[model samples]
Target: MRTTGGQLFMLVVINAALLAVGAMISGGTYLSPFNLQSMAGQLPEIGFLAIGVMLAMCAGNGGIDLSGIALANLSGVASAIIVGSFLSSTDNETAFSIAFIAVALLTGLIGGTFNGLLISRLNITPILCTLGTQMLFTGIAVVLSDGRAVAVGSPELLSQIGNGLFLGVPISFLIFVSAAGLIAALLKFTPFGLWLMLMGTNPKAATFAGFPKARVLIATYATSGLLAGLAGVIIAARNVNVKWDYGTSYLLIAILIAVMAGVRPEGGYGRVICVVMATIALQLMSSLLNFGGLSNFVRDFAWGALLLTFLAVGRYNLVGLLTPNKSRKLV
Candidate 1:
């Protein structure tokens, strides 16, 4: 069985249980369509970051991208500056919108590539490397924006991507689902996927087997950066402003989502589907807290506690506790 199967099941069960509890506490308003839509709409931004974290963790060598939310902020800020400059001419709305998305994606790719080069070539520790880049990205964003939020004037297309609904579903959520599906296919049906897992499982053995370790590492991180960039676009669209400090708790939340999804910190294993499930579950839990009239402080504390708990369990491979005793013996 997949390593994430147990966690995924647990998340589903927990999500249902939380919804039941929330409904009881809120006179059934918690299960209303409006609240559900709000919760679904909020999942994509952090979902993208969680996927990026999963990529880094799957790459091994104590790999992690601490700079994901920072790069996302930078991407949005850069895109907003460029697009806002051209908005005076309404005739170029299409061009400006396209340029906006392109800029965000480019920023993400470039930031990711920089991290990849340093880690893959300079042999820098992934944690320290990303930690430095995180500050650098935030610093650059602050400098560019003068330490203020850049207001985003909504272009119709960008607005649609961010807030439009289709068949009772959010467009942003659809984009996230499509991105997740593509990533899952990449990991399941590609040679690069095999090489990545092998490299993460044992870098030395992969090197002996003639894997292009540097190239793989660069590509892995580059993909992660692109995801962050896309997340920036979605965030700017939804919030109508791009601020360096938006979603200040996102960094920790993304890591928590990835860990809860059962992504191995030691590398070589993660499931995109599991990450998606975990994202929804966490969002539901957060929504539940909101329904209970809990403060943001309480939410943050809860998230911290959950992150620590999952980290300890994963570190010890205690996830097996979620499996059935009979299944364990068979395995």
Candidate 2:
């Protein structure tokens, strides 16, 4: 249930080495602790996507939302429109923020609920269900944006929250941490959480075990959508605009992070924290690559190599990396 120390140490060392390499490649600017903080900022949003997809995956060996990126984009558009529809230009930031959260949460729930029905009740395959939803969500986003961008204006506080630093940590990083903390708590402490893992590793066994399989399926998806929507809001808050294609690239990147984080694509074996760490590592790598003068192709190549290495390491090596004090024995 908890990560061990040696694995933790290995992860630290690996990330430290990567950080050093990234900083060295960037020369001076990327070496700063502040730069590290900036890179950390990128992890959370991507982390959200990874975790959201991971939850659905927990119920089956291969459950995932390939359209998660589309969900993220759709949420962003939804948030922008919500603000546009309800929020005021005057100055009451509190009301606007509340409205934004409510809209974001509800919209995400609806999307997730739909996907859950397709998979859980209708018995559609996860891959097919998500693919269909991905297109549907993306279309919804396009329609919301009128095939253009939804720009945020006069939301000064939003830019502050998105870009501001809280005690040297970016606000976006804080949001992710807060969100992750909550999710971790629920998964660790709730019956629903345990059921998810059970369902994933052996759905038939779980059914035989008499777990409320359908409820679990539906709940996981709904949670995923809610989180994805929140990520959208965060992105919108950061960029000060909701771009039609903002989160489109994140779908594959998220899946990559999930795999590297040691979450078994086969389901029922992963940790929220691992995904967060992998995401941080990935983002730092990305930032360093950008500053280090590597071409996008080279960066992508390195990412692929890293992913393969991570996969080869598998869950046990990664767990050993993240939690060394516990079982040295690989799963």
> Candidate 2: misplaced stretches above 4 Å?
1-9, 89-92, 315-331
Which runs of model 1 end up more than 4 angstroms from their true locations? 89-91, 315-318, 325-331
- Residue 141, candidate 2: C-alpha displacement in angstroms: 1.0
Residue by residue across 284-306, what tens digits does model 1's lDDT show?
Answer: 89988887789999999999999
Clashes of each: 0, 14
Query: What tens digits encode model 2's per-residue C-alpha lDDT throughout 43-116?
Result: 66788888897787767746988877788778778877877776673476767766766676677788888888
For this target, which candidate reaches the highest lDDT against the unseen true structure? 1
Which 10 consecutive residues of model 1 have the lowest summed lDDT? 322-331
What's the C-alpha lDDT at position 192 in model 2?
90
